[model samples]
Target: MSSNQRKSFFDLSASGQKKRLKAAQDVPLPGSGSQSSSSRREEDVPDSPVPLSQPHPSSEDQALGHCPRSDELELCPSASSSDEYEIEDENNVEDSSEESSNDDDHDDDIGIREKLRNWASQYKITATALTALLHILTSHICFSSLPLDGRTLCRTPRNINTVEVEPGHYSHIGLKSTLIKLMSGVSHTINTVILHISTDGLPLFKSMPGELWPILGSIKNVCSLSKIVFPIGIYFGKKKPIDCCLFLKEFVEESIDVINNGITIEGRKFQVLIQGIICDTPARSYILGTKSHTGYSSCIRCKQEGIYDKGRMTFPSVNAPPRCHEDFLIQRDLDFQVSESLLVKIPGLDLVKNLPLDYMHAVCLGVVKKLLLTWTSGPVNKCKFPSRLVNQLYSFVLCHNLSAYCSILGFPNTI
Candidate 1:
């Protein structure tokens, strides 16, 4: 770690909010964010230019010193969810420099060292609360520049080998016929996986569930976050806006390979998010009450026509409502270039279930956070997406091509 990073790490054991703020300055920002020596005035600190860490907004409004916002709470990966659980763990940092080599390296020195160790133990407790808050802020700002999840599909003669065509859902798994046809129409094999995670979801190794099996074995890479919510949401059907970004992070990580190896397919793309709880789906209606459903609303990550929800309505589709917003399409061409590599029939719940809870939680939360943040935050600097980005166009073999797609499949209002 760089000196700045080292300081930030050390700040993990800081005492007061002031010390925490000072420590935050050490996490230098890149490019234009860093301040130039010439621009530095007597009061202007070196790290001010980047605005890497903004003063706590709440604190700015308080008297005298900072806002004294909710006394910086504890944010360790291992803590109870209740307010009391956020209490700082009493452990301080040892100032190794203070350890004297004198006392002829005898028992006296040992006593002095123990004294320092004890003091440091208490220091850690002092720092924990501040550290947690700062980390919460750091995680959030760190992921502000995330990209969108691009779901694409490109098909042609090479990958398609389906001879006998049936109307109703293919009864059997039809592994060979379907896989080959899917493969034949496929132009590539790699996929770009973006995994979005919330603040709480980062340390997934310690939390993911052990009940599921891996569907993609070893192919995973290239993830990012649209927002920084803590603690990912992994359990089946759980959804929390605070944890929505986690899902996007995972997919982005795996997407790099998808882009490199997979052929093109359809091009519709959406982000994912992990709710703090088990989210059923994002589709709102009488289902998602009035509170904006945040990450719980159906996102492209979980966007699939259920038994009959289909077509373009306001919320759109038979399954979920029309999309609240669609800002995750920056890399449409990449989507057009890689969507075909995806298995349309893959089990969403089952596949995600295999991941550790923390991992899955992070992925789900990250995706949701990013999408909502970007959309609600409104209008960002972006280039017009390429038209080719829509290549994931799927072809349906309708009994009578009679308006295979109904303009308005369901009644207006909620459903």
Candidate 2:
């Protein structure tokens, strides 16, 4: 079957999305009204697997739950415990040498015995750190593996279509943020946002050093631009069969000229990012590190030092790496670098049909019901989106890791 065969309601499901996209022309789009009607149906809402030591029956994102469950760990692992080695078989993690190393990492994290009583309080984002580390490691193969077996920053690719939304770019308002904000007017609310980075094939996870290819994507949100770029939303409807490929084609070509040109913030000029994520509700936003010109891409280091099939060991030299800090402490998060947000809707399995608007609204409200933990509304540069918010968002994906990937077995995420 074609990769697009079982795509969801978002822009990916279109029959010819891939084949037709080549010359880097603008990816075609469906009118908001028509595409909304093209929403995919939810064929299934299977139980998302709960991670190690997490409560089951699951909520929005079971896979991400493990991050928070670390909260359950007693302050001291050696204080006195019969079950110190309790590895929940139900966690459903990949049984690999990698995971074994992960367990050791977890144990070492808990056993910092020189013990301090106020450690949790001293570390403001303890939960945030745990959430990021576990979620990135267990839930996303794309993120957990160290890039390049090391780290290599990637440089901007050549001739990526550029769009400058504002006159100048601000330090905080990188390209991705500018783009998402510019397209905000396109949708009343975004129900879902599918984020992926492209490479020639089997793209290396963001952590891998010097390993990358042009990272491309198709964002399906309520609004429709000529091509697939940031601000993906989806209304309820049956998306046209050709939308998938058409969108890819159009998106690859049309850079948000307005947003890309430049944004002068506080007098300094900066380029805008091409990619970003928007999965926040009234409380906060969880921005994925998909700035334009960023994300999965080949690096100069890789091109120069890489062997035919193997990657070279190069950290620190990896240019243009994803924005997030890769250390286990703060990996796999969705910090907005901005104010709080609200998630209006979240769809189910099939891309076409949504998980009842009311239901999604309730879910977002319930999880993020309390806005007490929001940021101090600091400037965007700090990603003031609040670590808690990012953790919650990661929780959404981590919780669904197994089930979601299982559904796409044919398209195993080689990340």
Candidate 3:
């Protein structure tokens, strides 16, 4: 149906009210001038049975023991109490025809709900946005069958416990369960499923020292800006997790089961693969139980020791000995390995190959942002461009409409 028609349905239902009209009776009142004439007219008119198809009065009307048609009873103030029982008897009988209209109204309600569902899914509306829309419509529109809660409409869980994962920590929803839910009814075969897991520490409050270290994972095939991102686990404390192995205990156990002996989602077994574990330098060091980025043995890819230059550790060697998975598993470098990583328990997962640096963290946000800030705001040097050259470059960007390009590169309106 058209949008206008859908809106009119609500408007008509809210504004239009069914008025109950009753037959006027010639009952005499306390201040009546034509008492004899009313009695004569009542005697002249013969009483007839009320039609079955006529709308019945509600229970409240029957309990009052009188008809409340004020417009018809303008001349006669008093109503006969004898008709009260008769009205009760009429109300007791079922009106099947009246219910047909209600059935049609219910059909219309279902249609409207279906349209709203399709519209929401087509436009990819967020749960919060759709919930707000449903609330607004429920409050203003006069719909008997309209849903008030967004979760009810979306068919999601109502109560999600934050303490369901473990005690003294935050929540952890399993990856295998989430994958089963997402890949329930697929047309094509999904023999292998790839995933990218990431963990990072975020400060919750600035006034206090509350931090959250969440283990987030996403499917490689469906990971996008528009898609829903679900977390594997979250740790909430004043600081980061004290023990990284203990924090990743549940994730490692669950991932091992799925990786070793595949998951059977809806009776279809599918193999799971860890595509990568994307993380920043500090977060990677924390999760992998290695020295921090400033340490001598902080290089994740190679076995080269960092040199302390200008009061900062730096990796100047380009031809360093590359580290392999076997070396990492065996802990060949004592300086590189602080403690054993729980991620090693997962079957068929490479500690080196499956832990790749993400472009956003390692390149765009890290190197490119630092380079731009240094060139634009840092002290003047040979690397910093002169004012005339910077203005020309800015003009060239405006001429080529490269604002979006600059924004994607992690710097907006800056050459």
Query: Each prediction's Cα lDDT score?
Result: 0.30, 0.31, 0.71
Q: Which candidate number has the best TM-score?
A: 3
lDDT score at residue 57, model 2, on the 0-100 scale: 26
Ranking by TM-score: 3, 1, 2
Q: Of 2 and 3, which scores higher on TM-score?
A: 3
Q: Can you give the lDDT of residue 122 in candidate 1?
A: 51
Candidate 3 is scored at a TM of: 0.63
User: What TM-score does prediction 1 earn?
Assistant: 0.15
Give the residue spans of candidate 1 off by over 4 A. 1-103, 106-115, 122-197, 200-297, 304-415
User: Which of the two, 1 or 2, has more TM-score?
Assistant: 1
Give the candidate order by descending lDDT: 3, 2, 1
Location of the lowest summed lDDT over 10 successive residues in candidate 1: 147-156
Give lDDT tens digits, candidate 1, residues 154-233: 11123322221111110112212222233343344344323322122112233643221111111123222222222211
TM-score of each: 0.15, 0.14, 0.63
Query: lDDT: which is higher, 2 or 3?
Result: 3
